[model samples]
Target: MSKTILITGASRGIGAATARLAGARGWAVGVNYAGNAEAAAATVKAVEAAGGKAIAIKGDVAEEADVIAMFDATEAAFGKLDGVVVNAGILDVAAQLADMPVERLRKVFDVNILGAALTAREAARRLSTGRGGNGGSVVVVSSAAARLGGADERIDYALSKGAMDTMAIGMSKELGPEGIRVNSIRPGLIVTDIHASGGQPERANTLGGGTPLRRAGTAEEVGEAIVWLLDDASSYVTGALLDVTGGR
Candidate 1:
């Protein structure tokens, strides 16, 4: 039988890519979106076209009720979840630490760190065998900025991603005995609209030449890594911070 997976922020970018790839692998997918119903719907169609079952679920990861609802709805649709990707995150216009307002920092941490924590918490509850659930996997989408630091820009976003890395590490140990595996992915410059949202539409391409690969990664590349972590093929892997950074 095929496995079931829920991907938060699946309307576009890395989330969408992962949904499609998982679908193609014959997994049922819950495509979760915060507000863009159209994009979520599009992702649903894409998943179905890729030959897997799918449903578009609307929920804000930053809201506890919404995160719970998203997971509840997914379980309702697919029976149970075998994996979850905590992929929902946000970035603001790039700015140095001093130039960034307190409100901006709050928004960044609220969605990136708190949101991820809430989603991962739900995953732990639903996937843990100790909680009357089957064993499963959880993948947190972090960023390379966690290691390099955003430096001149987006230090706040970088810090938030760093928290995600730590969360994955800690959860892996906490959840391991429960039969649930947890891992994190740190992606480098990749072509995604997130940069546009961060006020640097050309950031990925501009920085691609500096990487050893001399090109930015595609969402599909990162998606492949996530799917590997979620699949049984990587059953022995946990507490790993996999970098899809193309040797950055």
Candidate 2:
């Protein structure tokens, strides 16, 4: 049986990689993008090329209506969802908390916290066996910054991710009896455009050498972890935080 999944922020980076991997496994995918239709379309094409079905969904995760619509559109296109990857997140230019403006903080929290919460809430509504739907998994794309504390860098980003970690654990425990599994991935120093968006195009390569693996991780690496959690192979797993940090 072909399973269906929805990956937010799937237009690029780890989300795109996960979509492709899931597609290769013959899963139907919903590729959700906030404002990158071209990139989202490209991901949908890649999923189809990989022998799976895909659809490009446009919506901002921060908006409640948009998040609900994303799910409705996916289930409408591909039927019930077996999994959902809450991969939508945003990071501003690297700066200490003292130097960051209130607007920047709000923007980060709006997407990373509010958006993620909204997505997970809907997943619970749709995937919970107690809610008249089949059981499924929810994987949150958190960050290594959560544990690292961000220090002199963007502590706000770290704070948001820490909140994600808590949410995943809480959801897993709350929904476990209802047959919904929840987990999170903490990716470290992965080579992705998110670095460029953070005003550090070379951040991963530069800091990767410091890791015990002597290199930065790839989006595909993190994607693999996410896919594993979404798959039946990890049936016993829930509330776990898998780190794709290459031992960073």
lDDT of 1 by residue, 123-233 (tens): 999999989998899999999999999988899999999999999999999999999999999999999998998889999999998999999999999999999999999
What would the TM-scores of all predictions be? 0.99, 0.99
Residues 32-103, candidate 2, lDDT per residue (tens digit)? 999989999999999999999999999999999999999999999999899999999999987889999999
Candidate 1: C-alpha RMSD to true structure equals: 0.7
Error of 2 at 201 (Å): 0.6
Off by over 4 Å in 2: none
- How many Å off is the CA of 97 in candidate 2? 0.4
Task: Return the number of clashes found in candidate 2.
Answer: 0
Which pairs, if any, clash in model 2? none
